[model samples]
Target: MKMDGETEQLHVVLFPFMAHGHMIPTLDMARLFAARGVKTTLITTPLNAPTFTTAIQKGKNTSRPPLINIQVFRFPAQEAGLPQGCENLEQALGPGVMDQFFKASAMLKEQLEQFLDKTRPDCLMAGMIFTWATDSASKFNIPRLVFHGTCYFSLCVGEILRLHQPYKNVSSDQEPVNTFLLPSLPHQIHMTRLQLSEELWSNKETDYKKRSSKVKESELESFGVIVNSFYELEPDYADFFKKDLGRRAWHIGPVSLYNRSNQEKAQRGKTSSIDQHECLKWLNSKKPDSVIYICFGSTIHLIPSQIHQVLMALEATGQEFIWVVRNEDDLGGFEQKMTGKGLIIRGWAPQMLILEHEAIGAFVTHCGWNSTLEGIAAGLPMVTWPMFAEQFYNEKLVTDILKIGIPVGAKKWTTVPSIEDVIKQNAIEKALREIMEGDAAEERRCRSKEFKNMAWKALEEGGSSYSDLSALIHELRGLSTKNHN
Candidate 1:
């Protein structure tokens, strides 16, 4: 791709799904691309753009001029019968209105195609949920890569379970009663039917199943997958995804590490409810490795009963902690009771900053990939309490393979969790003690520290992730050259 006797720069377009979890990493990935001198454009909705503004501006000032661009398309919230500002999944997928969010997402396809036609980018990296993107990229002969927003372990586990149907042999969905091993993986991963989604086990074809099938098909048809993991993080599963599955894939993360500064870390995803300095000051007041940081990510809000149980557990353990909650209405002045002992962030917390703090020793997490990786990067052992989605799969990676986490014994899976899904105070306290107390806790911390070192090395100049990013950019340039000729 030579222009005026010099090689033309590659232009890459990133289209992330409108969820905080999905968009955050994709935004980091955009910065990674731009840092490598690739012209990058991030396609997002108007409302979603604000979440990314700070990070994007930081990239522009840090990097060469015009390295990144923002392309916006109007979200059809009204047509989808959603609230006017309901552009993101956090707002749109409420209760029975999930279909409306999907409908609105589908409406953006035509606009995206128009942008593709105008920009004619060399590569398109889109979120996995946007199945129609494969065809859109094909129309313009651009290379399309799917970003699944998870580790290779989960994907391998998911694909094998989907293909093998080993759960069928079980007579019941009970946890230990009908536990099964995922066959032919790098490790002997155990699972129960209760941990998996109903769509995976059920024979009935539902809307969710149909959508998943389309997404899987699109993944296979795309150029490759861009994973938010590094090779050292999950070597066996990474090998399995590429060699065994024969899928084209690249691992170029701990993407959260892209934010090298404290300011960037504080402003990574959304505005923090508590001031960054205030959070740091409180953490500094605690002794080293004394505070447990608890958060369930943006999507999963605990029910009142579940919240009460967690509070009871935290209180009973007498552990100093920082808990990020969706609402404080359920608290009923519990914050006052634990004034010096606890900090309850009402909305978003500066997770990356909090994780890296020296005073923080353990994490009580929902096992979301983003939080999981952040915890691993910070060398903090976790109390894994998986609620839904691929969180259970990630919990297995943490507890079984890594041996750096203690599961809180969450059994059921549901989007709208009920009383049955609530883990009692006793269970929560037990797991917390397991990760924060004995000689076993020290061993987990040692292992977690080793991973933290590996994560750092993976992003260095000649390291796995750095090399992978360079290789991807080189490949995209090759494609551009081929097309130009």
Candidate 2:
């Protein structure tokens, strides 16, 4: 396949951040580009490569000429003072080796620059974390598009908070219950001071603040932003991101929709611990919209005491549920106690497949963008329990703007939450009851289903996301022609 005026096919390079949530969507984006007849190359390290191999092979088997290519780079783990196989954030987070992880990631800059100088692709699409990628692409005269791995609503909210500084007027930064209204957003979203990162409140020039400043600076200098969402999901925020923020951006997602078959859905990011057939059989036994699907995503893990609270909540509600836990040992006979009522997936579960199942009713999510979009795609109302990062912003999108989720009252932004801050069994049970029963629950479900239908429509021919993708390809082709000439 060739462009209208060009003899060569347009080639684009994708570099995703080494996190499960980021990598999954980037792979989907690669396939989306490949399906449109564009040549795509995905750049990852050795440890992370295995996670993507199956998906790449599946893409090759289906697509003609196998447009998707995988390029592996050596992760400088040892050089950066990290353990030998620590290539991803999940691994690094567990040992509190984040500084080393960032150092290792920074070490990839020279290699990436050399690769771009050699290949000189038409465009470079990279994760937002790779702040150096902007200058690297600029060095090769290639347009760089930053992928935030999130939706426009969260981005808009973040930007509004940054510029307006609404939290500055709040009484005290230490007060977990102090609520502040986010100024100048489309919605009147209120957030607690505790839900925000400490860096936002402090005047200290820490490493995180410095890195964030660079990321924002790079975004300003980059060609455009790529969002993993559909316009219909948040029309106001989508428009606000472009018109008000004045940034060149594209929404060619619910990229998860690219997985057209059960096989693809079942094996999306990481290989599932449980068999797809068995998982499906369990879901089939339950009635429609009866089970609450619970997962906190790949990064966050609840402590044993917190896990116990969740288990007690599940038992108290007597709700049929599927909970994905980091370790089965944390369950400690609770799994046996809830035997028929709960399905405890020890490691990775086929999230998309389970979410798409008819019996899966409500979602208890961390409000990670990937999980948020997946829940939206599956038409399931959520119980949002944001842990860290921009998740609180996403929770606002769900509970405030979209009104398809009920917040589980998780106030503090923490990576390793203590028992003191654990969202209690009562709060979890309350959120479950609210989302799974009553008139309000039905309304939320209806709204969620509407977004789900819109998500599907956005991927169909001539739809919003579809047209945006086509337009992006066309724009890239034009740039490619100009670059060659």
Candidate 3:
């Protein structure tokens, strides 16, 4: 099915959500497409362009470079009434600001259409948050696929719940209902009332619900979805999505495992904000499977009280650890006390590298899909402490379904009397000890190791994910040929 001459040049536009969690995986996906000889145009605001520039530039230096064009559009910050340079979700933390973030995202519609007209790409690969991109692709008759930066298990449960509306029959929406089984799913999946995202409770008129509606509509009508998961990782869920949903999807991930053109083998282990050698030196000193690594991803900044509880819990475990604190202010004086026993990585940490370290045994994570997958890839069990969004559901996939994660008893964040229900130090301490020293740790560790191998195999030549990606590339090339003719 190889196209001749000009038809081989399949141009694709990747429009990811502004957040790092969403955008980073999409960039990796763009690289995958580029590696397969697809011309990729990454669309983002000027402020977010730098994040992908290094990776894009690296591809060009390779012998077989994929045509990766970076397109920068001005973020409608002022027009959306957001502060200057606040182009991403991580920056807009204040109440009612996410509304403005979506508003700014919508503002990109006209500019995106103008670019679509100029570039006339064969396909548009959009992030789940950018619902408007689906329609923009339709105007030009371009094939569009929404990229979901999560596993198939989460997606299957989410879609099943959305379609069946099982929660609608619950007696009280405000109070946490007992855990109940989802009849639609084949797995013994049970969800507590509170496990649903806080946004689900919002009225339909709210920005969150309105955006959700748009995403659902796009999911139903678009070409398909490109998920950051591999078929072997969740075979049942992946099969369900393909067979039941009746939508085309390609599971071409653990995309993090893909070699970045800029990150040479020697430089792959480096953290963004820390010196690589110095961090590696400390890790080298520790014994195998003796250290616990803790991080809560990029967006969810822990409050001072939550930070204190976590610090105390790590100390209670009495094991060597590395903790990533976003803001130094959150730790205050705690870093001074834990000097020899614990290492505090202020700002960014080399998460994937740390997880891969021989010294690292377990992870206490927020259950963000990227972090979860990274931990799995490293063959490490987890202490799940989900903060918000689909994280709670992800927590279930790890703790209950996979049986490789210990929960800290955090059901959901309560805001009635100021963000209450923070998991106390005792629960955190129990979870830490279970994963770091308890008997169950061995069982969890073995399960994690199995998935780690599967993740790697999926990316190798002739694997499920690799073949799926090739199929997707061929389909896009066909589209390009048809359009040219």
lDDT of 2 by residue, 1-485 (tens): 33564523799999999999899999999988988778889999998998788887765665344578889999999999998888899898854499789889988999899999999899999999899999999999999999999999888877877788787878875564478887777777888778888877777888888887888899999999999999999999889899989989999999999997888888898889999999999999999999999999989978888888888899898999999988644677787888889898989999999999999999999999999999999999999999999999999899988999999999899888987888889999999999999999999999999999999999999999999999988888888888888
Q: Which is better, 1 or 3, measured by lDDT?
A: 1
Q: Model 2: runs farther than 4 Å from truth?
A: 5-8, 63-65, 94-96, 173-177
Estimate, for each residue in 23-142, the C-alpha lDDT of model 3 and write its tens digit: 878777887887777788889898888778865565566676666788998899989999999998888867788788888888999999999988898899988887878888999999
Clash pairs for candidate 3? none
| lDDT (tens digit, per residue) of candidate 1 on 1-485 | 55422323789999999999999999889888877778889999999998777777765565344477889899999998998899989886576678889888989999999999998999999999899999999999999999999999999998998789899989876546689889999899888988888877888988888888899999999999999988988999999999999999999999899888788898888888889999999999999999999999898878899889989999999999999998644787798999999999999999999999999999999999999999999999999989888999999999999999999988877777888888999999999888899999999999999999999999999999999998898888888989978
In candidate 3, what residue range of length 10 has the lowest lDDT sum? 262-271
Estimate TM-scores for all models: 0.97, 0.97, 0.93
Q: Candidate 1: which stretches are off by over 4 Å?
A: 1-8, 60-66
Note each model's CA RMSD in angstroms.
1.7, 1.7, 2.6
